[model samples]
Target: MARSLRYFSPRRECPFITIDLGSIPESLFESELFGYEKGAFTDARKAKAGRMEVASGGTLFWMK
Candidate 1:
């Protein structure tokens, strides 16, 4: 169903991001979902776009 939605989405040029909530630890879920600036964390040497950011104007699917 997710694949089908992506296939026919109007925002086909945008991305389709999927995150497995079951695999990620609770402590890190926020950053992973919403992203963070550089130096936001001990290991965040550079800014990185999170799943939601990457899927901007597109589809964001979270699976447990």
Candidate 2:
């Protein structure tokens, strides 16, 4: 379904990201979904874009 939606989207120029929740660890889910700043965490050497951020102006699909 997610793939279908992405393929049929009018904004084809934008991105479509899909994350399988079942494959991700519960402890790391938050950070992966909502990224942190460079200094937000002890090991955060650089800021990274989360699934939500990468999917901005596009589509985000989550499967559990």
Candidate 3:
């Protein structure tokens, strides 16, 4: 079975950090989850930190 990722806060402390993934674009797959290099793809002009990197200090819930 497969599951769509949902970020859940155990304590429900910060309601402001909500992410409605329904509006997320498909193009953000690798570039978001996995780190990407500068010019990794055609549209990549700068090295941007991916979500995995951003979630380093915290928890990352990967549905798949």
User: Whose lDDT is greatest here?
Assistant: 1
Overall lDDT per candidate, in order of appearance: 0.89, 0.86, 0.55
Error of 3 at 32 (Å): 1.6
Best by the TM-score measure = 1
Clashes by residue pair, model 1: none
Those runs of model 3 whose alpha carbons end farther than 4 Å from true positions after fitting are 1-19, 61-64
lDDT tens readout by residue for model 3, 1-64: 1112223544333222223355556777666666688888898888887666765555454442
TM-score of each: 0.88, 0.84, 0.52
Residue 4, model 3, lDDT = 21
lDDT of 1 by residue, 1-64 (tens): 9988778878777888889999999999999998999999899999988888889898898899
Cα RMSD to native, each candidate?
A: 1.1, 1.3, 6.9
Ranking by lDDT: 1, 2, 3
Better of 1 and 2 by lDDT: 1
Candidate 1 segments exceeding 4 Å error: none
Please give, for residues 6-35, the per-residue lDDT of candidate 2 as tens digits. Answer: 677785679888899999999889999988
